[model samples]
Target: MVTEKNNKGNQISRRSFLTGTATAAAGFMIVPRHVLGGKGYTAPSDKLRVAGIGVGGKGESDIAEFAKGPADITVLCDVHDSRAANSVKRFPKAKFYKDYREMLDKEHKNIDAVSVSTPDHSHAIQAMAAMQLGKHVYVQKPLTHDIYEARMLTEAAKKYKVVTQMGNQGASGDGVRQLMEWYNAGLIGDVKEVYCWTNRPVWPQGIPWPTTPAPVPSDLDWDLWLGTAPKKDYVNKLVPFNWRGWWDYGTGALGDMGCHIVEPPFRVLDLGYPESAEASVGSVYVDEFKQGYFPDSCPPSSHCILNFKGKKGKPDVKLHWMDGGIQPARPEELGPNERMGDGGNGAIFIGTKGKMMCGTYGISPTLLPTTRNKEVNVKQTIARVPEGHYVQWVNAAIAGYGKKEVSSPFEIAGPLTETLLMGNLAIRSYDVRKPKANGNGFDYPGRYIKLLWDGPNMKITNFDDANQFVKRTYREGWKLGS
Candidate 1:
């Protein structure tokens, strides 16, 4: 293995040295940037070289944010040229590629970090590739599409010893910290039940796949866009957006918003893997007599209950997750006119003493009765992210591993994402069908079943069929951690 010296003159393996050394040798004598000024100083040219995968939609905004820090946008890759046009115009000098794998193959040496904002299905493989090449990574929310992928990435982050951050920006916000302080001070007096709700699936859901296939767009590389997802024909309006409703490309409303909503309770309560999960989903009626259940698409609404064992002497906690315009009842202590959780998406904690609530991103924290919010005071226990979420990762990458602490490191984000996806497992299981006794129609076997979870083993103890979803089989040519 090739090795390089750090600021402390300690020899470290350079996994990408073969590719990177030639580029550096052609230019100038390559000196580790941290050694330039002093022990802790960063040089003027020591900007983090970044490559972005899926540079469209949220990917576009993520790269733009990274540019605001001490970083250089070195390369851009997107499956669709039209969606990437804005980012390409912004970074006119950056090299462009239609395939992320191709970009990583040739440009791994040129990049110190990678930003992944692709669809949920592709996040794990792309991030794994970057880590294998010894590159720091900043992945967007819902870290992976499946539980096994989340476990693999968490372990890989430690093995590779690289800086990692997940794009659940609220993890760095002050609101969650406030909730933590309040809980620590015994303000809410040990939360027993929690509620998180969102009005998502703002796009189409609870429907069938389009019967008519559309012509692939000239600017889009359909094959590359599919990535690790199973091969399928292109349908109109699936790109740019609306993929959130599909299982193959997306993980539905829970996957889309769970990270933001469930994160607060996870942090404040010190939660771990849920012991068991059960869900009841809303149905769409295709006709007056028949209710629709499409295996390919997510239900229009769902309510999942996840049970977690008590920690630090508190009683067991029950977490309720509701989506599709569903919400919890207003706290009796709250004033009738006062807003409850920003009117749409929010989280509420019910404790023995009182209740507390916050909106999406864990913003606008408040204690029940409205007056208590102003009356209660607690010292700030957690340090705030001064430069905000995007810059936190940028600075950490430049400082090297273990120097600066990031808010949503893979160690924490991975589990939180896994817990959220567990709710998805229950939602999908609720739709499982079998032949009816009378042979007239199908019976929903998974309904009303509380799937016992063996967290350490990553298996469903009660239901065997549900195990198939725990780890998805990638397309023949696409491999994870390749």
Candidate 2:
């Protein structure tokens, strides 16, 4: 979930070096277990030797974090040779594999945990394989490519007694903790709805048209990059980072940024599965370059609404998600330069009493109104939140498996992830035309069916076809857990 803070505050630049472990100055923060770097370890008594799959982009930072403390980098794997090359330089003694399974089998004993930062579609397969080997996992979000895979991984994690964490580092952020604390303090008085928006109009936000085939980068192994995804000609539009807009590769906007932006409220409310999820949006354009890359698939570039029904005895909640298509009208109460909390690429929770706002990546969030409805005396007690999302995971891994609580536990993080993936399903299942009159309009916007999920069976009673898309047969050798 996204946590926003005042933009003017001392925001930690992503490129800046995180000097030390952060301490909580407010009552709502979690006391992070500080890391003593490599000095804390002596004898190897179950000290975690972790492996990393996909060491570029977010995976690069993930590897650095897990390697910081008592944990040793036992294996490094990536489809792109150069991406894996730099990681090898960092840990020269570690085994390296282009195929994740090869590393798992060859270095299984030396590895106690795996950090998975592959594309959305590969998350389940890599994570599940790691668990099958009785290895703990830290998977980036949205947890899995589809719903069935999520259930499969969740069950397998429990079955294997593995400590699991989703890479929604915001789950461990100082602002999210305060968001939950304020809710428990009845500041929002049972949030009825949340609006999450992003200016994330980058490579994945909108549908792009077809393009010419550009030369594949000499450094990347394009065939291995395709992995479980169906074979496609090497086109620039399908390479590097254009897969998110295509069905075969990425999960679009909702799948790409939902975990980061939607987590605050989902975590704080302890919201379980939604009873139903429906969507409304404009048609996506077919790209020339994507002619054979996708199965005639394109992601929407406009607004989409997703309605969710809470579990038994819980308040029904609605999530308004906006992307390339449209966005919520700016709140009129704020000043012109106020920038709707955290550069406007975040979320705001509207509750019965007041409202709260946060940024895309977790930062300390601020309470709106700064008071109760009629209480003029109330005010916000400002404070600083944690600086390092990586150290928290490193410290947990060093403390031994399942010994200390890491942020984004599978119990809460898994389901929260499942709910966001539901939005992805709604997008894939949407019937764009035939307005409300035909009972098929996504224009009702986010109004969706309540699916009766058979978690063990990995099927949805309400939407059989939708459920089928959750699990895809892997390419010959890439079959999961084989």
| Separate clash counts for every candidate | 0, 24
**Runs in model 1 lying further than 4 Å from the true structure:** 1-45, 430-443
State the lDDT of candidate 1 residue by residue for 342-363, as single tens digits.
8889999999998999999899
Model 1 earns a TM-score of 0.90
Model 2 residue runs over 4 Å out of place are 1-47, 204-215, 284-302, 310-314, 370-388, 430-464
| Minimal lDDT window, size 10, model 2 | 10-19
Residue 398, candidate 2: Cα error in Å is: 4.0
Please give, for residues 1-482, the per-residue lDDT of candidate 2 as tens digits.
Answer: 12332223432222111223332236644323233222222122345678899987778788887766667887889988766677888889878788887788788767778899988878888998888877778898888877777777877876776767888877666677667556656676767888887765477433333456678778777777778887666766565467777767777777778888888767666566765566654554434432111223444554455555654345778877777635676655445656675674678888888787888764647677533324633223323334345555555545544444556656666676677666666556533442344232123222355445454354556766566465777776677665
- Residue 128, candidate 1: alpha-carbon lDDT: 95
Judge candidate 2 at residue 448 and give its lDDT.
53
